[model samples]
Target: MSFTVAIVGRPNVGKSTLFNRLVGKKLALVDDTPGVTRDRRPGDAKLIDLKFTIIDTAGLEEAGPETLEGRMRAQTEAAVDDADLTLFVVDAKFGLTPLDKTFGELLRRSGKPVVLVANKSEARGSDAGFYDAYTLGLGEPVPISAEHGQGMIDLRDAIVEALGEERAFPEADDEAETNIDVRDSDFAGDADEEAEPEYDETKPLRVAIIGRPNAGKSTLINRFLGEDRLLTGPEAGITRDSISVEWEWRDRTIKMFDTAGMRKKARVQEKLEKLSVADALRSIRFAETVVIVFDATIPFEKQDLQLVDLVLREGRAAVLAFNKWDLVEDTQAVLADLREKTERLLPQARGLRAVPISGQTGYGLDKLMQSIIDTDKVWNKRISTARLNRWLDGVQTQHPPPAVSGRRLKLKYMTQVKARPPAFMVSCTRPDALPESYIRYLINGLRADFDIPGVPIRMHFKAGENPFEGRKKKR
Candidate 1:
């Protein structure tokens, strides 16, 4: 149920720059050279409240008409095929070129939604070229300077209208989705029921490694798999699609996936890039706990951060894996900085555990595996109501739900609703007023006290008194 926008234009049109601006990362290797981006990089593209997947494509080129460049262009064309909207970028400073015209014609012929973007239009002399964008027939071109961050508001409105998303950034503001299990010992009565299923400790928890291209995602996976199953090098981007492998660790069947590297949007110009990143996301959905890998050299680039955000948003428990730990100097300083940045940069999924390891040298692999095991435990944890209600009572007593419309909403009780990305349910007078910050506090508390680390936790607030008040509600 995700929407998509494909960024297509000739090379060196700042398509990757615009992609980095929207996805908030320098994921695409930017150079003065044309066609620097060969692979298609897709990220969870967001413009304020407009949430959609964005594909940063390689620049179209005039190759031997059937060579690699030609085939690459063909891939770019295919990206346009799947997009709900296309961002047609042009270099306003450089003016329109013949290649631009050719692709422009192809885009128009596709008959899909298109938004013409005249990037690098901040220079005084760029106006004439920006004006020429009108001739492309993609509609009134929005002049934007991706590097300097100009015309964003106008671009925001345009995207909102084009994608049909909200005008404001989404509410990171929903009530918790946790429901406590307060059923009596025999509440879940079943004619065919036997003893409760024994919690299997021997099962190797399924885990995944996901991140933008060149963020050391494959490196991390290699360390866990204990071999170089996937190729790794200094190349800016190497992964092409999701690769899954199975291994046993301490009698646990740990399945790991090394996924295609995702670049920020504009860099993803080819059809192959789109297919690659999509495959990685699909892997995350199947993983119980996904390890979002980050390059130790440049941790938390906008695209890498967004990938982590996407995993949690997709309802998967996530752990932060800082790869290439061996190359980093002053390890403690880096960890401290990472902790600070994660807390500030990713406030939505708070209390996420971060472990540093060198995927190449195998440093800290043991700790990483332990952390994964611990996080998986949290992901599958089901909190007992007696303990939960007690915690909720104390939390409410300390900091009651804030008043809404001069009517104080009372949160009567809470219980663990489910497990596997553990969910909690809070019965309250007005569930609407439960602040996001408060719910986060409860999750942090649960993680710390109950040893639930690294995975995502959900807490839900239901209106009215406890669902099981007085006579127990049916389990």
Candidate 2:
């Protein structure tokens, strides 16, 4: 019952920027470009004391259903219909344009509470065209800057007035908004304990390709395959099914899973979209490395960032493909921006290999494919028990996994029990209290010393009581 605020505006009106700001993270892709956002994306939005769901719709453009903009229009219209309140944004610096007016008219007719948001009002004389916004007849304009974080107080007050008293938040029932993201079939059905897995079949390495819808995932797959096997389109949701292709690169055969674009689980309503997300998660279970393809035009969107985060949390290897580099302007400046923002935002994905390429033009595709090969090599890497204990001895001397229950928990031994996910069994007492921070240290050391990349790593604990606690040991 939480009132939803749909940020509806024409292309490049700062809707995604505001969405990211409200979400308190750089979840949406923002650039000095127009029409970069396409899907009707919803996220946890906040404005000081106000916490509500915010929907960032694609730019509304004048086009027919056959065109991309027209499809975007359908998504935007659907978002408007689903929301309880709406914010009609306009580029105040560019002055009110016809598209803004058309968007305003559309919102005005919807009978939902509307707030006129005039964005980019931070610079001097920026509001010179504020008067033009009045013609939309949505009421007094809320001049705000999403990038500079200006006028948030006013925006918050306006949001509270619009929907604060309407109803309670719908998500209040769910204690935790489970952030379940990427899934692939390969990640599923791997709990076989007795049957020895064919190392040859499983050792080829598993890779999952994922990102927001229309983030060039299919194009990248096609480029790697050297054929037009997968369907590609500019519209979102072109590839509704996850397809697996078995191929080899330099005698190293690998299983590549091309999955549908993954978004927040709560926002997925369409049947096809749900199936795609489920399949992506399955892939993640088995994929050693997940290559996230992002549209250079709107790279690092909320869904994109979430997808990467899910991989790291699941302890999988990660790579990022900034696809469509050919369409991005000012490559140098953009890379610098990406470095700064990505460092501050995606801390979990620090040190992740990012490759800029155009899947359509084949620019930098070879490098991307090679990087994948190298990362897979790292992913399958293993270390001897002697080398691990040696490294562990050095680490323990430097700093040990502190004491709990006054016992000073000891890590007696460790060994690489399996590959694929690159799992290890640690022989240690009091396994339940092993702090997560210590686990991270062990993971970091393993990755650094063994040089693994883009694969999930599992660390198992075996208490030293006995191989059989109640039963007698082997006679």
Candidate 3:
């Protein structure tokens, strides 16, 4: 197993910045604001020659067990439990505070190796703070500027010495790239064969859980994991970045992304909030299946409907999840009202699957997962050209295209061009003259006839070539 290091510190001390730097990507959301990271996010980090797993966790804080800060501290403690070493970070520029000493004592009690890091050491007069950090009794502070890439070599050596291995830092000249030999021989036999298409169960299914702030998005994820893998509390907008965790449910690998709850565009004013929202949107676009979480107590808010519409527009397979069902009373009345609203407000996502779940109590989770599997099957549905043309024939016979300027517009042929949000192309006379309503009619017919529900469909019309233009029709 790869060695794991958990970065633990008080709020806003550049822990996430160091994480982003080590991972060589802005994987974690960083802001001047404190307590931005709520979940424990893991990344493959490389420092000089040391490659290992690094976890960026919420900053440690002292609070009552029921408060939001207390929940964040619990998440940090869990990450510490899973780590081979803990990097206790502190701001050298500002000097150590009482909270740092308290956190240091807690880390010491955990019985894990700790490395004290003095961040922002590039600032002048920071040596006093670095010296003071030694009193915490962790070790000599490794002073470095996480923002400017200063003192990394010293930090790398400290980590190597702490791990007690020279393998952590290899010689620069010893590493070489391997080249492959690809000379085909007659003894190799026939090489021209088309491999049969098959599903690879080894690959994890990427699913993004999204909803408005405080809608129990993170809670639902923690429920699925059966552990406090993510921070959850009564606080709104606690989650800032999209954190992915690999999990297995009933023998299937799933990569679940717990994204920051998205607020409406009008309300998202701060730069940090905008970045968080953008990151969430990126998760939705990349995800194979997106579960839109809804608070059953306040179902179908304006932003919720907007997010649903956005998911449909992106052509991603979706399942609507109503969370907090355990607290919901009069389930029949609520479900009936939800159905009416779904039909009225979300006609664009016709036949979408909806599941009622309680993230707190683990109710109806199996059905939620099954809905995702079924929706994915429909999303990847492929239609044979023969079948498409046959369906097109029946559709055109039932409702012929309207005449344009006294000339009948003829739809000649149809064929599926692609799947995964199935797309089709049709060759027709006066394709441009075919009205938008006609296209909608064709799309609707395709959806109903092919049993495509809760997935977007694309249709294209190609004007037919004139028959007499290329031939001498008059003998």
lDDT of 2 at 254: 67
Compared with the true structure, model 1 gives a TM-score of 0.55
Regions of model 3 farther than 4 Å from truth: 166-203, 465-475
Q: Compared with the true structure, what per-residue lDDT tens digits does model 2 show for residues 357-386?
A: 898888987787677766655544555667
- Per-residue lDDT tens digits for candidate 1, residues 1-475, read 1567889899888987888888886555566667765556677666765666788777888786446576567667767887888989998999999888888888889888788898999987999999899998878999899999999888877766665644223444344323333222211222222232345678656677887677777666666777554556666566654556678888877877777777887888876567667667777777777888888888888898888889888777788888888899998888999999988998766678788888778887888788777776666666667777788888778777778799987878777656666677788876777778777777787777777765667778888645566895578
Q: Once model 1 is optimally superposed onto the true structure by TM-score, how far is the C-alpha of residue 286 displaced, in angstroms?
A: 0.7
Candidate 2 local Cα displacement, residue 65, angstroms: 14
- TM per candidate comes to 0.55, 0.52, 0.88
Model 3 TM-score, all chains together: 0.88
After TM-score superposition, the amount by which residue 45's alpha carbon in candidate 2 deviates from its true location, in angstroms, is: 49
| Predictions in order: lDDT | 0.75, 0.74, 0.85
- Model 1 worst lDDT window (10 residues): 183-192
Number of the top-ranking candidate, with TM-score as the measure: 3
Pitting candidate 2 against candidate 3, the one with the higher TM-score is 3
What ranges in model 1 sit over 4 Å off?
A: 1-199, 465-475
